[model samples]
Target: MSTTIEYVRFESTDPTELAAHRDGLVSLLRERYGADFLGAHLARSEDGSFLDFLLWTSPEAAARAAREMPGDPGAAGFFGLIGEVHDMRHAEVLHSTQV
Candidate 1:
């Protein structure tokens, strides 16, 4: 099965706040979505922008989670930490290498 990937970008001037947001979102994803939420990779740019590569089992599953997240009480604390999503896109993984 092809995995769905979400490419996202957000900007934050405060590194500490950004880290906290990232952690909270990751924890929420894991706790709420479980195995359907594959995981995420985060990176910091020189200008303090953040890029998040979120992996999911499928596009449909990802969409459902996204749709419900806003109404989930557990997700409330994570909502504000996301900052401004400068860009967001979904893709099917073509290839990958893991150690």
Candidate 2:
């Protein structure tokens, strides 16, 4: 199966707090999703908005996380810090290279 990438663009007033919460969220995902959760990256744009990239083993895994994450108690703190979600999307990984 091809990998899937989940992208989320959002704003957060307290980036520091959001970063801290992100650690816990990542840990929770790793524990829950195991190998299906490939990894994630959080980036801050020049305009101050944030972008999150989550890599999953398949589209099904990404969709399942999207459906369940909001209701997961461990994710509450992470979600609470988001001021607004500008966009969210998922796409199949066409190509990837790692050294």
Candidate 3:
């Protein structure tokens, strides 16, 4: 199966609040997605925007997880902290190189 990557970009004014929300989301990812959740990473831009990268086993798995995220009780606060979603998309990894 090919790996699917979830690329999300959002803007936040409060870094502290964003950190807390990121932690909560990570916890939820582990608790809810478990093995299906390959990995996650959070990054910030010079303009203060945030980017979240999530990897899953497949596109279907990623889609399912996203569809159910808003329904997760723990996600309420996290979602609230995300002030604005600049962009969100999923794509298949066609190639990769490891050293």
All models: lDDT? 0.78, 0.96, 0.86
Q: For residues 27-86, what per-residue lDDT tens digits would candidate 1 score against the true structure?
A: 888988899999889888777778878899999877877688757776666555666779
Top candidate by lDDT: 2
lDDT of 3: 0.86
Ranking of models by TM-score = 2, 3, 1
Model 2 agreement with the true structure over 58-78: per-residue lDDT tens digits: 999999999999789999999
Worst 10 residues of 1 by lDDT: 74-83
- Candidates in order, TM-scores: namely 0.79, 0.97, 0.88
On TM-score, the stronger of 2 and 3 is: 2
All candidates: CA RMSD in angstroms? 2.1, 0.7, 1.5
lDDT of 3 by residue, 45-96 (tens): 8888999899998998899988999678888877777778999999998986
Top candidate by TM-score:
2
- Say which prediction, candidate 2 or candidate 3, comes out ahead on lDDT: 2
Greater TM-score among 1 and 3 belongs to: 3
Model 3 worst lDDT window (10 residues): 11-20
Q: Give the clashing residue pairs of candidate 3, or none.
A: none
